[model samples]
Target: MDSYTSAAVDGHLLTPVTRKPPLRSSADRHGPISKLGDDLLVAILIRLPNARSAFLCKSVCKRWSSLISTSAAVSFITVNRAGSTTAANNLL
Candidate 1:
């Protein structure tokens, strides 16, 4: 298995690679989720087993705190996405 891949491999001696973590973008360094819009975030949060679990995720950061605080925004969209009477009711 001889190939010119990462510069970290220098003749079989496994050198420690000191590479920075992959960034979502140069402007936003928070994380991949931080880059998502409110609707998208709500979609993801709604899948957290139950509302309490989803609500607790607000402690993760200010953006989440603000978003989760707005229950109408998250609930309204979550209901629509559920698209079933029982599923929508379960969201409550």
Candidate 2:
């Protein structure tokens, strides 16, 4: 039976199946960053230092534009800018 197991269906059996290769990380798959959840992506975008950069990111695609246009995202940027202004005033 072991010998026949390696033989083809007609009469010969093939070699035993081997283990599967390791899975690739999501970032390694060349998928768009938009595949990430909106909230998560928003968190990442909010860290950009410049509002212009964030606005430019919106034009990358429809999903990104929609995310950036959301009320929460807009408010976040506004708050961030206000905070930066406050920090600059404190430094003066």
Candidate 3:
């Protein structure tokens, strides 16, 4: 397709294609999860508006879904977002 049509076809402006590795890679020893490790991913998730990471990692794999739902991870994320739940309760 022509460059002009490609850009205009979608609402977003299109740019020249660039090569990039996939989010996940089986070949890598660290594997696909290397894109965002457990610690970094957890940090990013907590910064989101809500528990959006739970929904996102669900489709990644059953193992990932289980990992995010654990009490430790959930509590950590909750705490990082805005302190303990008790603080929120006090505000309410």
lDDT of candidate 2 vs native? 0.67
Residues 4-83 of candidate 1 have per-residue lDDT tens digits of 45655645654455898786663276756667776666666765665677667879888788888886855754554433
Q: Kindly list the per-residue Cα lDDT of model 3 for residues 4-82, writing each as its tens digit.
A: 5564555777677889866655437556565565665666556655566554765766556776788987776666563
> Model 3, which residues run further than 4 Å from truth?
1-35, 52-56, 82-92
**TM-score on alpha carbons, each prediction:** 0.50, 0.50, 0.42
Residue 73 shift from truth in candidate 2, angstroms: 1.1
RMSD (CA, Å), candidate 1 to true, equals: 9.8
Order of models, best lDDT first: 2, 1, 3
What TM-score does structure 1 among the candidates reach? Answer: 0.50
Give the C-alpha miss distance for residue 69 in model 2, angstroms: 0.9
Better model by TM-score, 1 or 3?
Answer: 1
Which lDDT values do the candidates have, in the order given? 0.63, 0.67, 0.60
